[model samples]
Target: MRSNASDCDVLIVGAGIAGISMAAHLQDKCANLSFMMVERRAQPGGTWDLFRYPGVRSDSDMQTLGFAFEPWDDDQSIAPGGSILEYLRGVIHKRGIADHIRTSTTVISADWQGDQACWLVSVEGPDGPEKVRARWLYMSTGYYDYDHPYDAQITGLESFAGTLVHPQFWPENLDYADKRVVVIGSGATAVTLVPAMAEQAGHVTMLQRTPTWMSVGPSRDRLARVLRRILPRKLAYWLVRQRNIRLFDFLYHAARRNPHMAAEKLSEGVRKELGDLYSPEDFTPPYNPWEQRLCLVPDSDLFKSIRQGKASIVTAKIDTVQTDGIALEGGEVLPADIIVTATGLKLSLGGHIKVSIEGRPVNWGEEFFYRGCMISNVPNLTFVFGYLNASFTLRADNTAAYSCRVLNHLRTSGTQIAIARPPADGLVEGEPFPFSSGYLMRDLAQVPKSTDALPWRLNHDYLADCRDFRRNGVDDGHLQFELAPRVTDQSPVADQPEMA
Candidate 1:
């Protein structure tokens, strides 16, 4: 029932920013090698294409979020969703990478064939199931799942007469205009949706099960424009990127090192904005800022929406859903024509695919991380994880650069397989992984903790990774490879890693 798929030197899953960037980088280094990128969606731009809620914009500035090869040419630093998607599409076209992408092709499973020492990838396409063999498999499926909403099973959800929509699964034809909307959850999605839906809806009530640290800053930076005019385009871009990087770095580090100081600085800003309307006790999180990402309300737009009486924030746990409203745990009833569940995303590290070597599954939770790139015993696979502070692209760029170096090294050494094995001690002592909740927590026990990984201490520090990954090779004595002498008129030998 399966068709044979075309073989390639490398097969990349996902056509999002990470996948595209990886392809672009690979093309630059190895021109002769063939690669194919498969995206489940009809188009590129993974999250950008999926999220269509109003007021959707990058939490990070475009300068940092954008690809390294292409500079985002726009007046606004904080770009809207449409612009970001356009930029990605343009990057795909300009790089001539569009031809290699297979849209609507979903990778079902990747199984390592020990006999062939290659990956036998099963993909589902329009035609049917197809199998493709590749020497290397690059997964850019992202750390989060694709628009799979985490809807809490409310008692009366099925009986509710009104339209119930999760932001991730927004119905295209659903009209919110003049309708009373209740937005559940208080994370970034809810914060962004409340103001956006408020614009069209008659009223929006943001219901939260818990408190989140919300910080408001200007959506559009006037200084960005002034600098753009004064300085060259590239220089301006670099300046803005660096400025934001340093600012975030300082704030994140200050919060980690001196929680009291960070809290004081954050409190001053909140007090000025809300005056007596907000209480510090209720709003402030028990954890330090950046313990989780501080939700950014661009240009105080969320606040403006609230000030205009279009939106209201209610901090309480929901008891259940009613026929036409929501009942709070404290016996309060709030009526709504639509319920928008803006709850958090379901985290799936490496797309939650079970990775196995031979017949044994690799326990990512129990493994030690090597240079934040390779997991111990995981050979020939390198994952690109972005920084928590700066733009994710920065860390991805470093990962690409490191990959180039590693590949080049292998080529020069006449090595067929390379792997990073953890030391025999089995215990990796370091800082806790930066992320605190969702699926990440569930699999934390098996995955490498941040403390064990260098330059991956939760905070985004690009310069450190730049120097480590680019300037120096894998430093922890972890990178291991198998070598086979080059043969005349013969393909490179495939060496499979030994599974535990």
Candidate 2:
């Protein structure tokens, strides 16, 4: 509803799951709206495309992780990375929004123009840098840094005469056949790599400072397979999706509310899988369940590998990176021909884009997370920060629905600017995001602040958020609308040309 013309009505900044979901929502609900999606990578799939490491897969099930509009037709709920990438690509093509996306284009900066009531976005395409005006900006650029990962700081890493690899930048065809591999860190990546590399490697060892809680799950959903046979495809998908969403939401809340029972239940699963191989020092984590996500081992692959004598786990502090392998603090050396550093990702907010309001820079850390959607006092910008406990696309789908609501409101009400006003009454500060993962904890100061008040907290409960959004609606008095002077049929953004 900007008085001034814009290049597009809504400009999506990434072509990932989140961005594609927004596009689908717009395509279905607001068909006439002009929108464009820009992806830095040549491909549409974000994390799925970026991460190509061994045994790469989703920890969360594809049932709820996949978009609401699209039914994940695969039998394997805990799918491989390739399957996920294909599903994501299919969503855009099936929805006929492939033409709305521009690949190999990066959003460098976005500045809000108050006078024109639009965002002047700077993008670096293949040719050169260009600026475009948009009524709104949606950032789906993900939580982690694309180019770099968090440094593991492995001492004498360079001195070792071995193939050193990080999961982020997985090299092509660098064969490790029959090679002795030592994968550092006990996170999900290490759990995945140990078993995967164990298939062909002489032996694979998972080295960890502290043990992580592990759970056993099947890759294929047995009930989903049964339902698919009896019910229609779409209906089956919906039922399966809902079942998974509720199950995960329940488990996450249960873990937090009753950490003791949850921890015991989770450990029991591991003990059952490993049996004689189970050791308290190797499987028991110091932290409570959901403190850090319990790593999933589909079909007990990690445990199977250990039982089969193909892989093993060593719990000790890494003392140094020796010439042949890694040295432990207890003077034990682990021989390795290859070292895989599965040390987590680096969290980056707003895709590290320099955001400004006309000439003034915006400090995102100072802002409060308004209704877990928009940042406080920020106008026409929505960022998708997914759940730590549940599937990511659950939030992506919900965010798109909420975004459409805002867009519809703006068009119908004839408003130019819609911003989340900072809390008026004195509200005490709350936790920003309650996740205890090292990656998130390291960069806690970079994200927005949270408050004790309702609609001010950075919520993790998707079920609560979805219900609240549907029941309460957009006009909560916190999100203020501006420049509602006239009733005119003029649309600021003309229809976009097929993503050129």
Q: Which residues of candidate 1, in runs, are more than 4 Å off?
A: 1-4, 352-354, 429-432, 442-460, 474-476, 484-500
Query: Lowest summed lDDT over 10 consecutive residues: which window, candidate 2?
Result: 491-500
| Residue-wise C-alpha lDDT for candidate 1, range 264-382, written one tens digit per residue | 77777777776666676546877777777778877777777777889887877778889899998899998999998777776566765656776577776666566666566666676
Query: lDDT scores for all predictions?
Result: 0.73, 0.86
Per-residue C-alpha lDDT of model 2 across residues 199-275, encoded as one tens digit per residue: 99999999998889888889999888999999998999999888988988888888889999998898889888889
User: Where's the lowest-lDDT run of ten residues in candidate 1?
Assistant: 491-500
TM-score of each: 0.91, 0.95
Name the best candidate (by lDDT). Answer: 2
Model 2 clash pairs? Answer: none
